[model samples]
Target: MKPKVIRALGVVSALLFLGVLIAFAQPKGETVKVKGEVVDLWCFLEGGDRGADHKQCAISCAKAGNPIGLVTEKDEVYVMMGLKDHQPGKEVLLEKMAETVTVEGTLVKKGGVQVIYVSSVK
Candidate 1:
């Protein structure tokens, strides 16, 4: 095999490995104090109203493992999850649905969708 071809193959291999590393890298989210109402993202996205009135249904959806988000006063919804073990925590959010609460966590953005990884919820 030609020396140039061998060098080119090595370069390609390195690039592929770099790509894999980037793919596996944990995304970084800015730490923020987010004050909002826990909401069922499925309902919020579908033009459903969320407030004291929708509390029961929102809690039900959250309890059922549906997508949950924090709907800020500005009307922005951020998908919420527990930072511990990097998994969703619907139980912590179930009763808080449609109620105002403060969440401190890292805000991460992927594929144009914003998500907040909660370190603590209150």
Candidate 2:
């Protein structure tokens, strides 16, 4: 039809295509359920400090933007992070430090480090 209309349609189509490509290019993770005690990764890994005595410290560290993690009953630790939508998983972890809870999330592992993009906790 009109030249301007044709150009606008072409630009719109290109934008839609680019959006789909970016969505597909994002990394995907396996859904998993992990049971563990939430801990501040800094003190937990650096000095084995965790559990009841370390609960307040863990919460403070999380509020200060330090990374949090889960220590499984089996002794496996998975770094806690927000979901792909950028949901702040640390907030959830902050409430449960030194307390065992079940976490549902997308599990991603790379370079020998494991992380959980948390979705739910109970």
Instruction: For each candidate in the order shown, give its overall lDDT on alpha carbons.
Output: 0.83, 0.87
Model 1 misplaced regions, further than 4 Å: 1-27
Tens-digit lDDT track of model 1 for 6-94: 99999999999999887665457689999998889888888766999988888888777788999888988899887755577584677
Q: Considering only N, C-alpha and C atoms within 3 Å, which residue pairs clash in candidate 2?
A: none
Best by lDDT: 2
Model 1: residue 12 alpha-carbon error in angstroms: 33
Worst 10 residues of 1 by lDDT: 83-92
Over 1-122, each residue of candidate 2 has an lDDT whose tens digit, in order, gives 69999999999999999999879745489999999999999999999999999899988888888899999988999998876555455766778888999999889899999989888899
Q: Clashing pairs in model 1? A: none
